[model samples]
Target chain A: MDTFLQVLIAGVTMGCIYAFVALGFTLTIAAAGVVNFSYSEWVTYGGFFGVTLYSIVGLPLWAALIGTVILCVIMGYVFQWVVFRPLEGRHFLTIVTATIGISVSMGALATLVWGPYPLTLPTFFGNGTVEFGGISFFPHNVLIIVLAIALISVLQFCLTKTDIGLRLQATAQDPDAARLMGIPVRRMRTFAYCLSAGLAGLSGFLVAPLFVVTTTMGFGLMLKGLAATIVGGWGSLKGAVFGGLIIGIVEALGAAYISSEYKDVIAFLIIIVVLLFRPRGLFPERIAEKL
Target chain B: MRILSKSVIAAALAMSFAQVAFADDIKLGMVIGTTGPFAGGEAPLVNGTKMAVEDINAKGGIKGNKIQLIIEDTGSEQTGAINAYNRILDQEPSAIMNTTVSGFVLSQMGTIGDEGIPTLTGAASAQLALDKKGVEPLFRVRTSDLYVAKAAARFAIDNLGGKKIAVLRANSEFGNSWLNQIQSVLTDKSVKPVAVESFEVADRDFTPQILRIKDAGADVVIVSGDPPHFVVAVQQLKQLGLTSKVIFSNAGVLPTTIKLYQGDSANGIYGTVDSVPAIDPARADWAKRYREKFNIDSDYSAAEYYDGVMMVAAAIAKVGTDHEALVKEMRTIKDYAGIGNTYSYADKGDGGRSVAIVQIGDGKLTLAATIK
Candidate 1:
């Protein structure tokens, strides 16, 4: 049915966004051994940065996106050096708490600078709907899905086939062993943080036109990303993507068939069911023992 | 006889001191949500309240006593509102202006009634507020959601000829109230909505909901929600290729929301508003001044709050800050025209029944018809 296809496409589009943010969560957790709770705020900052560049400064979409990435990367490094670095050798709980503090502070800062009203970004792709096989889809939605898939594939290739990727893997596996192999483990961790932040920023930039840009926007995405990571598998990139897609499709279907009020509840129920049946998630991280 | 006279004199002196303390300056307490979900409209409400106080004082103050406004921020939660109400009560203000959220107002109704402080709310329009017994001291400056919903339903069915309607609303007090009223009015007209969906205030994706509405083949979609969410819903509805007519509740009349979707996506979306200053030259001048002063577009909240503050000032001036007298005076106010709308309280303290249907036109709200 066209309605079913439309819902499917919509779910996939949302799932892709969840996957991007989940990728950030998995990247930070894998590389740093501490979950960056503030990862979603990076996405929010990225959107605000895009608003400044595109809406206020009148930059082209691509140029504004590039500016957003640069700013987010710098912010990632600044947060790492300023907040996470000093607590590097401290207890894991300390780092997590610090990340929470960072998240709150970043949200408050965004609100202070931009106020609470949501800002609009110019649509990059044309706003027209394209009909394909009797189902209508927005060009922007298609672009988002394609871009998310491309980004994920590129990240996958880099993680599997590059020297820096190997270094990152080594650092995440065992910092002491990685350092012994002359892998500059700390620098690799910083690099992972930057990449994760950049991904979050990119997701924000891409989704801003679809949704309104607000400081609280990242919080919802962060929760969804966390849910995806939990449902897929901790510290598994592929699992995060799969988890995000699963959440998106399940939520859409649940809302359509059941009640819209329970859509979020359905997502949480899936997380619980996954945790109960397989604590390691739907796709358990298998490389730990191998590494 | 001498000892008893001395005690009476001391008691009289204490009572006189208390009266002097109360009369030093007329204090009005304001509870506004400056953070959390409601912060989007906080700036204008606070600015309007402040401007009203300034306007009053500049005119030689109420009977030469300067009106003082003590503001408290309800962090957009019931507990926060209750706490702020308690703090405001500690100041012993002559009257209180509560927050915009109906849930917060409902939670504090018993307390407001027990304290017998004449309270005015600019935005909370839940019918439950009026349905409750013992809410005598509570007054609403804005029209109730029930009234606004009736107007919206009439416009959609009567004017737009939307036979098959779909209702989409946020799951909040505001949304729920509007839903009930719209359903009641539509049922009375023997037209039932094809589909009804509710989303959370923070929800960004309405694709699933829109798809369902599209499938139902509704001729028009009636929406009731806060800003940005409404804006996103409209955009999504357009994107989903559902060319159904869209009608919005009073909450959707915001200029900022219209500007967010100013293109073809925003055209022909109808909404009801308490007032459109462009219709009245005097109101237009006030709106212009308010925009210049606050650097934000003037919405119903700003205008209603300004009028609310002035109403409190007027009551204080007429009754000299007597709590019971002030409550009586507020109820007795009849057709007191403010910048936004006229205030005339019914026996139960509900005011402002005038509304206008406005359609989005070229990034602005153009008045279509006035309903009383």
Candidate 2:
């Protein structure tokens, strides 16, 4: 029973990370109607940016995180203006291919700058763990869970309640009509892209201390985030979170009960099963339909 | 006009002869992954090889003929390795050094056997490489995982007195081979591991695995993984409060790895190493030279490859670059001391039998015991 609880907590912690990455995918796909295959590189670059600020530049952890966010915001805008803006109404495959190219280029650039060795981030929590009710939790894990929930709550509130959120939703649903109604659809799209990039940057910053920061780290998370987005239903924010949690818990349980070798296989099997039953996803884009 | 034409033809003939004479230099081909996942290890190997070539050439060359090294990047893949091998064969190299990855080296066995070029490798520590049927020309400078595992098992049982052991290995060719050898050694000693877990190479979170190991009440944890993964596991182990004596395979003995775990937390962790520069002044000097040259800290891979290059140079000098003569000379080398270890190729082409047990003490690698 204790083992089960510990694994559950571990799974949830990992699920939160997946959810954060998946949310980045969700926001971009909803806004642009194209999947950003290079979204994971944003996470990787963000983590390395933090490494530069914290380890190389000798900034405090909080300052480093802020620097990462600012850098990611600029990166997001540049990617939009330079890469996506030119490809605006082109073939969906063309945009995705460009994103893949971006991903590869970023990985190469990182390797050229930092070399292939993985870098370590100093943990803010100093390797401390908290035990309560016979459950032991690393402070980093607790922080990840709490921060993920808070970020998601803020995102949900903004998307559902704010006027800009309505405009963003309006643009995603029908850019033609949104523009006809005097809404700046392009601006909303850029804003959504920047927001999504910020979320990915935050996830990267949070995960670096737990794992080694390497250029390839984002590629792995990209696959997981794609799996989550697919399983949860495309363009469904709440579904992305659920999909991530489900993937994480199932992987942990599979590793515990079945075999670690087959954990990834089991997670993909769940995706297959979900696709077979719910062709669209567990939660389809109902908001888009309503709009 | 006829005299001018005749002069041009004569000059062209002279240039051709000069080219042939320049090509008479002994050529040694090196296939390494200078770019990709194995780049970290191969970079140092390349530097060490260059240093050996320079040192040999500075001493009036081997047999008064300057050695020419032809380097090709394997890109850490079998296809890339095959392409590199083909390119090297085009140059008609007298000998070849295979890449660091075992799988890539094994993939090139047919070519190595058919060509019969004298080959030496500092990587590819799999025992099967020694026992492979078509590896007659291939020699290993690095000791196999079997020896490292035997040394680790003996230390765990005899030195540390660990009864309930836990084995956590990366799911890789090297890791699996080491795990099997360690298990065999432990089973012979009438002890079985309390828990066994395997993680993928890219896995970051080991919380569930470590928790399970702790639940099994293991007194010792034997880790077989690469440096980055090993560092993460050690940090996670400390975070989870599992104070079991951790023993690492040779893969985790890099100085940079130790730097990641500096201070008290790093103390008492044991690992098997091929060489520690602090134990020998000659090795220390070699390491210092390497650092000054490459601007990076040297590891066992660099030392072994340095010795390999020197051995090849000596062989070329003793016997001309004839394939059969080079092979025979390499086989006859007995206890030829190098920067890393004294290498003696057994009948099966396995050399370097020395393995040392070392502990991380006060942010430094301290020699504990030598296993021969």
Candidate 3:
């Protein structure tokens, strides 16, 4: 029972990270109407930015995280204008290819700036293990699990029960109609981009303590998050969350129970099985009826 | 027409003079991992190479002809390693200083042999030194994994008095070879490992593996992984409260890795090293110089590279610029005291003959024993 609990916690913690990254993917697909493949690079940028502010610049941890999120927001805004907007009227594949190129360029730029050494940020709770109700946990792991849940819940509330979110959704559903109805479609899309970028930054910050900060860190997260997004439902926010958790939990449980060497294979096998059966994922996106 | 002929003749004469000067300088080529997962280890290796080049030139270079050092970055990938090798070869160097990655070296063995360049490497895999295809010109400048693995297994059993060992290794050629070597040593002693597992190089979490090791009730766990992977494993092992005496391979015992690791997690951990210049009084001068120069503590990889370059310089000095002659002279190197270890070039391409076992106390390494 203790072993199961330990594995569960590990899985859930990892799941939160993947879910956070997957949310960015789902948001971009919904609002921007195009997948930003560069979310992977944005996650890496978040880590390097955290390292720069907290480790090199000596900012307090909370201040550094906020600064990182803001930087990512600005990065998204600039990218939308510089890269996305210029390529918006072209084919969808063009935008995706450009985003992929941007990911590569960002990775190279990071290597040039940070000099390729894997760095670590100091954890909030230090190295002390926390014991609660007869179970031991790394305090950072607990922090990741709790903070991810709280932030995700707040984001869900803002999206589902707020005026700006309705406007954003209107823009996503039909930008031409939304523009005719006095909604600033361009600004709405920009906001979605910023929000998603901020989420990616937060995920990267959360993962930095658990993993070393490296230029290559985001690629793995990107793969897992993309898998999660697909498995949950294409563009459904709730699906992204559940999908990430499933992948993380399954990966951890498989590693613990079956062969550790084939852990990734097992998690990916879940994807194959899910796709074969459900096709559109566990929770398919709902399309509103046309008049 | 007369003026044009004069200018052409002058240009041709100057070009020939330039070529003569270039030929007078001995070009030594190097390929080291400058990016990706191997970057931390690359730091010391690069610094050591730089220092060696400087020292050799300052003492009046090989045969009074200054050594020209040309380096290429491997990007820590197989393709990158091969590309770096080709780029270095384009310079038409006298000899090539090899990459520290065993897999990288193995991939390029045929090319290196075909080129017939005297190549020296710090790669610890015993396979590199074997009498195999296209490895005749390769020389290992560090202690091979066979000796390091033996020392680690022996230390775990004899020094730590650990029984019921568990092995967690990276799923790579280097990791598997080290596992085999260590297991062979254990089996020779009539001891068998309780459990064994493997993980990819990029894996960050080791909770599953640690829990399994705990479940197996292992008294000792031998980990074969690079710095980044090993650092995570150590932290997770501590987080899960594993009481096993953990032993790590050499790459994870470097100063850069020690600095990245949380201090408490590293305490009581034992690791094998090619050298511990920090604790070895004989290497105090070199270590001090390295720290002052690079503003970083030198690890064995750096020292090995330094020794490799110096060995090449020595070979060039003894046998001039002839590659075959240089290879013969390199093999004759006996009791050549380097900053890392005293090297004697064996017939199997081995140079360095010793390994050290160290224990981490409060994140700092203390030399436990040196095995030769």
- Per-prediction DockQ: 0.50, 0.48, 0.59
Task: Please give, for residues B1-372, the per-residue lDDT of candidate 2 as tens digits.
Answer: 999999999999999997876557888899987655566556667877888889988997886678899999786678999999989999998888778787777788888888889888876456435564337688887777768888898898888899998998888887788788889988999998998888877677777788878988999999988776777787778767898999998766677677666236667889998887544566778778888887767777778888998998888777878898888789887888888778887565477877898888876777888887
For residues A170-269, write the lDDT of model 2, one tens digit per residue: 8888889999999998999899889888887888899887666777778777788888988998888888898888988888887877776677888899
Shift of residue A235 alpha carbon in model 2, Å: 2.8
Question: Candidate 2 chain A — worst ten consecutive residues by lDDT sum?
Answer: A282-291
Native contacts retained by candidate 2: 0.29
Sort all candidates by TM-score, best to worst: 3, 1, 2
Q: What range of 10 consecutive residues in model 1 chain A has the weakest lDDT sum? A: A282-291
Docking class of 2: acceptable
The Cα error of candidate 3 at residue A241, in Å, is: 1.2
Fnat scores for every prediction: 0.44, 0.29, 0.53
Can you give the lDDT of residue B362 in candidate 2?
70
Q: What is the C-alpha lDDT of each candidate?
A: 0.82, 0.81, 0.84
Evaluated against the true structure, the overall lDDT of model 1 is 0.82
- Candidate 1 C-alpha lDDT tens digits along B196-256: 9988776778888888888899998898887777777777777777788888876666766
Candidate 1: TM-score?
A: 0.91
Runs in model 3 with CA error above 4 Å? A286-291, B1-19
